[model samples]
Target chain A: MADARRYCTLPSPFPMKRGGALHGARVAYETWGTLNAARDNAILVLTGLSPSAHMMSGAEDPSPGWWEGMAGPGKAIDTDRWFVICVNSLGSDKGSTCPASTNPATGEAYRLDFPELSLEDVANAAHVVVRELGIARLACLVGCSMGGMAALAYMLLHPDTVRAHVSVDTAPQAQPFAIAIRSLQREAIRLDPQWANGGYDIHGDGERYPDMGMSIARKLGVITYRSAMEWNGRFARIRLDAEQREEQPFGFEFQVESYLEGHARRFVRSFDPNSYLYLSRASDWFDIAEYGGGSVMEGLKRIRIERALVIGVSTDILFPLEQQEQIAAGLEAAGANVDFVALDSPQGHDAFLVDIENYSRAIGGFLAKL
Target chain B: MADARRYCTLPSPFPMKRGGALHGARVAYETWGTLNAARDNAILVLTGLSPSAHMMSGAEDPSPGWWEGMAGPGKAIDTDRWFVICVNSLGSDKGSTCPASTNPATGEAYRLDFPELSLEDVANAAHVVVRELGIARLACLVGCSMGGMAALAYMLLHPDTVRAHVSVDTAPQAQPFAIAIRSLQREAIRLDPQWANGGYDIHGDGERYPDMGMSIARKLGVITYRSAMEWNGRFARIRLDAEQREEQPFGFEFQVESYLEGHARRFVRSFDPNSYLYLSRASDWFDIAEYGGGSVMEGLKRIRIERALVIGVSTDILFPLEQQEQIAAGLEAAGANVDFVALDSPQGHDAFLVDIENYSRAIGGFLAKL
Candidate 1:
């Protein structure tokens, strides 16, 4: 089992988010398995939203993913075989350096003083971590949704460091729909009164911003992570209390509303509001074309990868089947060895998380070919 | 300008939104055109989300819609001829009986005490006004979106009163996607501290809820109302301010963001927040089949209309062309003379509001034949 001891901090040569640069803003990350002598056996995993470097992979995994079943020892990202490394993304709340992280210079958390981070800035920090980990070359870069997005950024910024990019249910181009949905979630957080215009260090004034804000934001993410068809099938607009058939008397007595609410409350416990905001904005800002001066092909042509696998779910409306095709097309245009396998599952964007057997087999074969 | 010269206090026959049953709920409304000798030239144009009884036609220079150029003299509605009657809908901020309207008992605003109105409830309220106005039969019943939805409910309830029923951009059923979208808007309002649990008396404590919440909600509305292609063409991530030239900042930096915020602000000024919630919920809860014991076509068959025109916009992603097609199919199945028109427009869900020339000509022709 991979433990927290694998975590390492690589300081950024950039400023604090709120203000002046931190001569070297530290990026805390972790690595799993052993790097081969050729250093080509390494795989980098970028965290989604607020996930720390510990995108866990082990035998008796106590706490699976946040992607638990997907990236385990005998899973899609075969931890027992391939050396996996995940970085606690910069501007995240989990064990990483972010607003909530205490500023060494000021002896206080950066809070409002935290520097504003774009996807580029976040990627730069991850680049430094990969470089400092003594893995000059890599076999693949894999991630999901936002993490998948960060992986895209990693490939673009550190093109020479990796051999291949394997995106799980991700598109190189940020579609308008995804951007729109992500903006809604970001607005939900930024609009909170206690977010205090991005201030409030101590969670203070006996007025901690309501946890419901983050909860609501997470529910928004959950909706996007899956398809409407999935919700329709899984839940029958069921009321929370079956016995109390009060009908639609006055308020939201339906089970669906209660179901969404419960989902929201759980997100409040494990995730940080600011990290969610940062990561969401990062995903929305993801554009390989933007990085390449309006040519996605030009951007990808720079990638020197031996193999690439683009995986997506059938009913995953968020990622969609077409998006995976686009990713494969982009890689093929770049003359990279690209193979796209459409995972037939109704889990929507979350098929990678739920459909273990299929994903694990596909991942194993992809890695074996590499 | 038209004004209601004579009005009477009336009790609502339905149960109050809070606990007690509301009686004598005064309905305020207005009429256009001269009553014929036979007293049957009335064409009821039901108001949608924000418009007042003043879905104005011949007011001075002819006020642009609250339908935004859709209904006007010589337009599809043709206030120049047909007796146009548009009321401030029940549960609206307009001069209709709503949350903000004064409660007879306490003389205070009904606010939260306003019942969670169903589409039927809204239609019934309009029903009372139509009967009181001395119109034995309507020449045509026309509604758009939520109002369009209300028209269907009205046709179901008072089939004898409506001669030709036209429902534009209305859903035959509430898909989870639609319901979830509406719920997202409601959550935005409820989460706002100033909402004060919907008990915020509009005139209370200077602690007024930021109409900003409603504005944001409506801004979200504006996004759904129009097409992304249209948005990209009109305001392609263009910076709203000089500062945003380098990056896509939050708030109203992008022209699109400014466009959304403008809509939100305008909506808050003219619309009731609580009504927005109730109406949105009503729109989400609208299931013609669910209401009619699982047979929407059976319900439509009962509505005896001379002729009807169902209009759908090709680019209307929100209302969608499918919904309009469904309306026509249902009406045709019901043995009604129905002509269906699908207008090609880039206006998306708000094609009815934006594509005035095409809509006017099409609707005008339809009305002439009817």
Candidate 2:
């Protein structure tokens, strides 16, 4: 039951999907449990926009991962029987090559000069990491939200690498409404004077980042990530305490406003503004149809997986249930065995992160079948 | 038949619901058709957050209002037979006593010093305008969105000002979800460096009006105002042309992004940022329960109107269908004849504006019975 965080370096001049190359490219990952002699009981877990490689807590880390409840011993993922590998997304700021990383060519941070990222690039990087770990094929690949897009890309790029796939709360391509929301987020970062046209040296100069813009962007993101029904049921126009309201300069009166602002503040501390811009834009540009000559069915057919399970939250306004239905329909049309599960959860796109029992039942059932 | 925009001056020292009187308060209004001899055929119209008093085309102003199709001759409110009056809500920037207007006391713009506005204040101001016009309301009161909130307030305050009420796409009070969105909107403007803490003058320095923040706020607003179903159906994943994308500094690729940006730009130019802050806050503070000392049912009991029509759009995430249902149920419990119509529209909160024929049919049918 060894658990450790590790890194895998790609060969120099790694090719990217959007006609660019990266030098000294590496991916940081964390693994739990021992690899069996056959190396066949491995599972790869991809993350949403802002997670680190720390997918679950272990004896070494003692700190919870984003999917704290679903990936432990005897949990839905069952690290006891399965070796779990979680990779930090390539364009993220968490111990991976990103806008915050130094450029091999310039000897300085890449900043905006970082090569344009595509979901395919993130998937390819993860695949290279998997091969570096001496695993030939995974038993399953599990992804949620943006991670779902990356998992799909991985299946498309390296067909037959995994026996099963689970994509939760995601779409084949970013819908127009989602894209519009992301565009505004990018604009919020770009408009901030503190961003300085994406050249702010947050680490070196100890200068403040675009805190206001990024916080606002994150607030907007929180609104979209959760369901209105959830907020109404949870907050319900309750006023904040006078002391708390007094501390806020903007007269934050409502409890819901306080909740949004608190989350935004925490996000601004953890996330790099440039990394957010690149990853958000990358998700917007990702279209599965582009890989299959303008047909999602054709693209899905390229994946060599035997079985797929897709889960969608009914209240998810960001990636609605219809999007998951599309994924299931496309996979079924492509001659793959697909199980699509729609859960009625008030948590919206965040149900995968919050509704542990529902997701555990679905994922555990699918894994048991595998 | 004459249609012209007009104005009415309220007697000095107009008192507001939240306290603090406004001196030399005035209201701008527009009228369609001649008043009947008995003054019993006058229908008063209230506007949403951003509309002017001009609710329809007129002799002097041929340009159409927000409800152009529904208020003309032989239409919903039938200007041919009923004298229709639309008042610019108090605190609006369109020819009304808004933050941009001169303060009689200080001889400068009221700005944030403008008395705290409530839906009741807006309703009261409109009532004063109606009385100054020598009209004893008889026909009905029609309001949509914020206007609907104001109409409800008017019915509660005056109680017998109108015989029938038509509230479209609005709730009795702003829900927690709506308030959270609006709080973010206000924070966007407040955080902008250009806003100068609500002191930016459009007429004087002209350069420091928080244009970027307001634009972004308006863009977020437009997204909530419409439905995801409508955006998906209309825009899908269509990319903007190279020429159009070139115009955006943030690399706007989707047509929906361009659409939101365009609408936001227009709104930033036409709307006063402070007015948005005030009116949005007012809506959040509006609670029918507060009027009746903590019971919405008791509040509804105060309205003397015998009949009412309440319409809700199924896709309206802002003013959800359940809120309108509550409005109808409350009115019915209070012994009033109420017709509740839930429309399956993809336009969301803006359905009352875009789905003109459906709204017209409902309102016309109700008016005809009256």
Candidate 3:
């Protein structure tokens, strides 16, 4: 029972959908359990905006995964019966060929010259990783948020690669509201004087990264990821220091403020600002209808999956429940067996990550049917 | 018949509700129509976070007001019949005693040295101007957003200052969700290197203001001010340029991004960052319950208005409809004639500013009954 994180390089001159090519592109992935002799018991797990290939515990790296609750030996994903593979997204900085990666042509960091990335490219890169692993098909494909968009793109591009698909808390296309939020995030990073036009030394001297701008962007991201009801119920205007009610010019007083700042501070340390900008733009530019020559239903018709599951959180303002409903409707119209579940969770877009019990039940039940 | 914008300096040593005093403090105001011989037909209108005392077209400065649709002659507020007085909120940069004002003690700009401000202080400052004008009582007090909070404070503090009260798009207390948003806005300004700890020379040459930080904050403010449904309906993932689809490192390619950036750019030129910081904190610290033994009902019991109207928009995520309901319930419990109108508006908290027709009808009808 060996669980190891591994890396594999794709074929030389890997082309991107959005007019770019990587000479030496590599993908990082983690695997659990053993692939059956038929290689039909493999499951691929794709992640949201900020997750690595570590979906669960591994022998080499035993640190907990982002979705550790769902992918253990007898958990929702059931590693005891099925093999699971989690691949880091193509343009992400975490062990992937991203802005932080070295360019083969110049022998320097890609920085701002990493080439344009699209959701389709992330999907194709993951597909190549699966093929390189000698798996002709997967038992199921699970994705969340940006990963959800990538999964759908993969289903459309490589229709026969995956037998089942599960997309949670995502939209077929980026809505104006969601795009506007991401656009501001990019602006925050761009406007920072220290960013140096996205050419700053990310790991060098004084103020190497745009930490202030990225921190504010992450703070705004946290607000959008969670519902107001959840914040109200949890924080409720409680002061961080009840004893020190005297006003200060600039200070973190409210519990919600402290919560957001703490999260943002931690994120600024781990994420690359350039990679964040590229991946966020990829999500915004993703439109399934565009791939199908202008109809989402036609796009769904291209995905030849046996079964599909779409889950949405009721209070998710970022993706909204209506988007999931549309996804389910599109899959149903495509003649695929679709199971749609709407969870009434106040965690909003992050409900898929926060409410583990409910998500595990939904994912477990959906996988049980197969 | 003259509609004139005017200024009045309060007597020396003006005390604040909080422990601070302002010397040579003045309030800028605009008056529409002549006060009746009895002076009982005067209607005092209060503004939101970013508006001045120009409710309608004035003789000296004939620019249309922010609420020009509802405050014109024979309009909802009916300047032809009822004289209207629009006072600039204290601590606002729009011709009020704010961070930009000169300190009588040091003979320099107050900057961050400006004493802490609260909603009660704004209400009290406005009340002094009303009293200085020799008006014993106001026919009505109409407020929107932050102005609504001030109006509630005025009603509680002054009790019999106004005969009728109309609050729109505001809550009696600052909720944790709203506080978190404001806290982030303040943090954005503080983290900017150019801010110089709120001592930036806003009028100095060569990028004196913290434009980038303030712009991002304003952009975030704009998003929260409007509803997601409104943004989706207006600009749903439209490209700014069809030909420039090829990705650039830092570029504005979405229509929503253009809209937000344009708004942010304009806001940076007009708004002072220190003023924004102070006023935003004022809104966050505002809690009507704090004034009345930790009970909002107890606070509302002190307001002795003859009639009250609380208007809320259904899609207003910042100030939800339930807060307005609570306001109405408190007023009803206090034995006042309360009119609670909940509008199904996609404009969110900005419905009071954007959907003028609905607001006009509601406010006009409520005033007509009085």
Candidate 4:
């Protein structure tokens, strides 16, 4: 596979949001299409928690990316007429300076020793990459899921950097339900003896990995990522064939259980557990209220943009549609032209990734007018 | 504490629904009010997964039972006019023959050696107690949550035994979403190194218990048992005081997290993990469709109850209002006068337990008319 990623070194002794600083850190990013001479057609894309910088297939790397359905030459995020840059999150394992990265001082993985991560820190790191790419200002900024939270921080910290904004399935802050789910996910990993207090062998066989903990965490995540409605329509109460079930008690019996098991197994060994812990906690800690005198709407009003489109799915329990409406109302109160669209997508918070048709229509229409 | 519970030894070699049989098994029960001369005023109460036979406090045991608010002298299921019998489930550790009970053949705890449990088994065992009490027929049968599933199996397996039925928040079969949640809960318990393949030291101290795994599982349960709306209204984005947080990386921070931890800690050592696993899986494996030629509606049609009252909460994501409506429609089609009441309670699936006002009104009204 051709290499599609580019790295930009962050300022040494980069200040973190909570505490401490990184002596030497870098960010990885990928871009599609060409940047105009005016540097005004650049659209910087921020991703959810787990995705890499590669958002779509391109000449540099032909492998299909996570958001391949929504971003391409003529897709919703049409690269044919715009420049798009997707940045890997700062606390992710996908070619970024994360907890899995080596610490210059100790010559070992930072692990839990990494400074507390915040959306502000992620925004700052992504901003460094944007500056290095010679883009003085972005024409549009698209943030999806966790990326939406980071995007809010980005605009609040670096005023006037973005002209247009598209917030997809994100909240002004972490709600109690979201916080509870994340806390349990973190507990699942920490309870595993194999985790060894974030000191598990990073380069070892399955025996040394926190496989069970990570699998349980990932399974919990997959359950909440999609809506119950979608699960009802898809798997229903379907049972697995007797031949497919394990002989032991409490083993996989239902198709839904099998599906969750498959997802967990595929994800368990891929992501770094420490990086996951950091990112998950950072998401819970982020609240726009911190910036707005304990008011989410007030904090949202702090972001000044020319135009905004806030899209949410009705079935999204993680970040309900009301949060998206609040964003639109807050942005509109700030004098930005805001278009709020609530789509009846059964895909829940993951609608932006799977309900391409509905998302493309709302997003494409918003960008076209912009 | 007084010994309010009564025991009735089931017929020796009590055959189970799935395949195995239990010898010298006994069921625990408690009764309020008095059996009428005609034995026609008897009301059999079936409980959820975890409750004991003690549904409410009485003269013998002046302690608050699980449904203290709804059952007593003049409460919803008024004991003044009806004989209310609460039976502990067959596979529960609460004063019943379960995985925690001794295996007479081996003189050891059943543990994983317990026979595969089904709701049918629970209903049959409860029926044995009712029959031993000299009740030829019941005036009404009340089932809540998991108990409701057992009630369905009860009425289907033994026709004409129950004249009226009250089905609380439950489903005809486990949906994929509920199955997924329960599957993860079971996995959490089994993954604990201390589980020791269901041979963990039941009588040992905290060091020998599957404390971490049970805590995680209970936390997950608490998360699902309540609604997100309730969490938003109750805890919102409230953070815990620094003094309350543990001085570790991923320690409790949010008030909701703290609340879940409190609940988990309180429940971790109280229930037997092996029994929990059996009952949870039994819930997953239950389906009314299994008896009605693969049609849930047809299965409902087979039950010969005269009148039925189905109660569900609007905010309940576990059972949902649609399932209640399905039960009502199916029973109505079967010539029974069914009253379906959907209460707009924010308490979710647990509303039947906490939203006492609404539940009392609906339940009291139904029984009064009878």
Candidate 5:
């Protein structure tokens, strides 16, 4: 059912400015389905802020992919047909080179010891995976949110290697609003008394870590995970269970309190606070103009790719429709065959995950054309 | 030289549901300028998240009131002329009836033991203050953000008390997105290990204090304080001085880290975490429609206020221009004279504080007309 275990490292065409030393990165990934006879059926699907090979098909570990809802046997992704490959990114929360992992220079969890990581480095790591897969060119590349930026990065780094691109609900560059929000969450995590300068052994004994801080971060994440309308419909001063919640005698009688507490707890246990910090910072540093030859239009001009499908959501404030237009306009200006779809949804920023019906139709239609 | 303590309190028309027992309560406040012979010069200005009765005045305390910027000699509020009063609302961090106040039955801090607070309670509290002041009616009423909602609440509760209203960057309802954000901050405090179920003394020096939770809550607050543009321009990737900032061997070498840390530390020390939770919930629970018979428009139709000013910030995602237009159009439909101004800024929601020039001009012009 799956052919896996193709790993590779590449020397970055771009350099990391934060660190004095040249950065060489390795990418670990898996391949599914099969390359068509002409090798033209290759599709690239990128993952988001955290997670690893877990973006797609799971192995003996048997954990489901992050896109379990959208990518399956009869799902929009249709793994039964198009060849798909997902890679573990560099500087990630999972089993890849990240701040939480042992640093090469010194054999210890990087903690606050990791070098300042940039999006360029992360994209470069994916580039290594792409080359090792030997696809030569991709039929279509689709990404969501942070992963969407990586797809654009792939198109930017190796212009000739992609035939079509789909950056769904993504930004051309990092907005100050996103940065402000992320910065606040990171500050929340690091400010915890138990964080102890990021040298935390959270898994060991109930010895308090930044548990409260981690929970707070997750609560913020949950706020961004869904649309404003969805939250309104589900919770409006719905009081939390007085007996089960974390308040003292006669404390917060409202339900919203535990909702946030549960949300933060779920994420904190699964994610590394340092990786969250690095990845969020990397995303903030991502600006197409800075990395894409001083302008995104110029970056696309260099692309020899022929086709692109730019999908956007009307209510996505994080990656408003305008940013997707920028990419489509650039690709069209470069004489590429580009299709644009600005779908409507109440889900802000995260329409890709929630608006399944419309998203599936868009995905199915785009793939059928290929 | 300034005047002596002239602050006073007024009993509410309704009983407070904030604390367990139905204890009759009052709100404390101070007024500047003078009431006209007809008491038509009376203008009510509501305070923000945390402040005292001395809002808009040079008080006995060393620190100026929270709204000192908009209300002083020759300022937009023009305290030298109109009789402007600022009341410390019920369930406030300031010395008013709140969770921190002694419960008549228990004689202990309400802590998490207080009953749920609603906009009606806040409005009811203000009603008492207005009645006690012997100001038969108000010429105009103005509020920003949380206070803006309170102003609307007052209009709904007592149509005869005020002749006009002004709501700057606020909504008649707290959308789910607003509730979600507030919930995160609340959980951050409640989840703190040292919280000891909401009974921990804020001034206690034991390591068991929940400063960690307070710090996290403050960090989240800082995020909402200003626009993402401010963070990008002011703190983007800049590194703090080695001697001044907390030294991390690597990773967080950015100046934003230091800025957030210092900011969070100050917030925790100055504000109580539980108070933060209560006020934030109050903001989320604010909804005029729920109180004024379901339809937000119906709520306004009952308001006999004659004049109103609705202000919105162009860049404020929290309170966009659309929300302001809704306020303006509603008041106009109700046959009330309303002035709506949209101030442009890159500061997102906090433009109310940063864009002083235009705000001052608008407020001054409005005050002069009255």
Candidate 6:
């Protein structure tokens, strides 16, 4: 399958936010449309923890992307009118210089040797990619989930660079509940003997992989990503057929268990555990309060975007609606024209990816106005 | 720590709900107050997943029990006037015939060889203890958390035995969300190498214990047992002091993480992993719909009780208030005088143990009327 992936070499000795630096690092990205002469129609897209830069398919890559339904020609993030660019986050495994990437210094996987990652570093890396594309000022910046935090960092670090912003189902800072969940997930991976202190085999070599740890971590992620309301409505107390269940003790008896098992199996083999650890820890450390006198709202107020659309899902337990409201309030407090829309989508934190109609309508309406 | 624990040997070849049976099985129990000549003041208490028969300190046991604040001389249940009996469920590790108990036939721990357990089996075991005490009828049967389901089963299987019931923070059947959480927990345990297919070392011998898996499971349990609202209100982005943190990657950073670690550390060594797996799976299999012929309300209606007090917490995500409402509605439909009290407790599903004052009032009020 063809992928419309492009790479931009980061400046050598690229300094990290929490100290240390990387040399000869590169970021992977993809663009959807032609950059106008003025470059004012350019829009930068940042993704959640797992998604790659391929937000939508193009002529170079006909295969459907992660957000294929929501970003394309005549879609919510219309490629027809906007020069759309999406970059993989710095510490992500999807074509980014992450813990899974081979170190230029030793030709070994960075793994635990990778510098402590922060959303600020992710933002700064994306800035390198954006500048390389000859875009002095972006017309808008779009970020969803973890990407939304990076977008906030982007605007904060480079004031006046982004004219508008769309923050989708993300938090200004993670709550204790989210921190606890992520901490447990990281523990699950680190505790696995096969993880070997983040030195587990990434290649399909004779060495073992931390499949069980990754499976448990992914299952925890899946459980938190969606809402209980959705789970009850979708699966209820439905049990799996005997044929579908493993004839073992404590095996899949319910459909929900089977669904989670399927999700874990699909995810464990594809994603790098070390990369997951770095990103998960980075998410926990992303407290906006550190930038603004120990206040999340004050930190958000530092961004200089002119107009912003802050969207939240009502059923999101991880990044609940209150966080989105805080984002909108903080931006509005900063003299930005902010439109806060809380969708009654039962898909929870992952609503932006699944409830395409509502999310598209909200995004399309906001973008059209800009 | 003197414990006010007693034992009752169950009838030989104790039949299980799913299939199979246990021979020479025994149930652990503790009682407070003297049984009246009429035997009409007996209150049978069914505990949650982990608690022992010791519910409160008494003449025989000086140590404070799990429900130390709610069931004593002048407390809610007021043992001075009522004969209170609390029993450890059959599949629990707490002084009961469980997966951790010795199989008389083999002279080894039952472990995976233990039969398929059900809430019905737990109810039946508790019934034997109550009958052994010579109580012809229970004035009130108080069941909390997982025990609440057993209480329902008790009312259904042995109609008219329990005159009044208090179902606290439990579901008629496991919802998909709850099932998913539990299944992930079981998977965590089973995947641990030390678990060795439910044969983990229970004794402090050379064989390794599934501590990591148990720790993960316990952390998940603590996360669901409490409310996010309470977490936000209590911990709210509070970082542990550098001195309190472990100098390791993905170690204790947030106060919530520290709290969970403390909980997991305290619990992992005490509980048997095989018993946990059996009880956790039993919780998933419990469906009132099974008894009601595909209807939860119908199954609840089959329970013959004169009165019931259904209590739930507003912040409970596991056994949400909606399930509490359903319980009340079902009992009322069955011609039982029902008093449904939904407390605005921030403690969530474990509110019955923590929000002592509110619970005391609700429980005490109902018992006083009885």
Worst lDDT window (10 residues) for model 3 chain A? Answer: A241-250
lDDT (Cα, tens digit) per residue for candidate 1, span A207-305: 566464565677666666765566566763444566543343234555556666677876675665666666676666666777567876666666666
Every model's TM-score: 0.87, 0.97, 0.96, 0.99, 0.84, 0.98
DockQ of each: 0.25, 0.71, 0.77, 0.88, 0.41, 0.87
lDDT of 2 by residue, B1-370 (tens): 4546677787778898889988888889998898988998889988999999988897878887888988888898888888888999999988888888899888999888898888899999999988887877657888889999999899888866788889899998888889988898988999899888887865633787798889888998999999989988899889988887755345788899889988987788688888888998999988898877887777776777889999999999889999899889888887789999999988989988899989889999999998
Model 2 scores a C-alpha lDDT of: 0.87
Query: lDDT tens string, model 6, A1-370?
Result: 7778999999999999999999999999999988888989999999998888988888999888999989889999898899999999998888989998999889998989999999999999999999999998999999899999888889999988999999999998889999999999999999999988887787635368888888999999999999899999999988788799898878888888889888888898788888889888888888887878999989988888899999999989889899999999999999999999999999889999999999999999999998
lDDT of model 1 at residue B346? 79
Which pairs, if any, clash in model 3?
none
Per-residue alpha-carbon lDDT of candidate 5 for residues B232-287, written as tens digits (9 for 90 to 100): 57765455576765454223445665565677766665665566677777787676
Best by DockQ: 4
Candidate 6 Cα deviation (angstroms), residue A363: 0.6
Interface RMSD of 1: 3.2
Candidates arranged by lDDT, highest first: 4, 6, 2, 3, 5, 1
Q: What is the C-alpha lDDT of each candidate?
A: 0.68, 0.87, 0.87, 0.91, 0.69, 0.91
**lDDT tens readout by residue for model 4, A237-342:** 8879999998876899889999998998888888999999999999999999888999998998899999999999988988888889888999999889999999
Location of the lowest summed lDDT over 10 successive residues in candidate 6 chain A:
A198-207
Q: Distance (Å) between predicted and true CA of B10, model 1?
A: 4.9
Candidate 6: where are CA atoms >4 Å away?
Answer: A204-206
Candidate 6 lDDT (Cα, 0 to 1): 0.91
Root-mean-square deviation of each candidate, in angstroms? 4.1, 2.0, 2.3, 1.1, 4.4, 1.2
Q: What tens digits encode model 6's per-residue C-alpha lDDT throughout B1-370? A: 5667888999999999889999999989999988999999999999888999989998888899999999999889999999999999999988889998899999999989999999999999999999999998999999999999999999888888999999999989989989999999999999899988877777735468888898999999999999889999999998899899998777888899999999999998889899999999989889998989999999988988898899999889899899989999999999999999999999988999999999999999999999
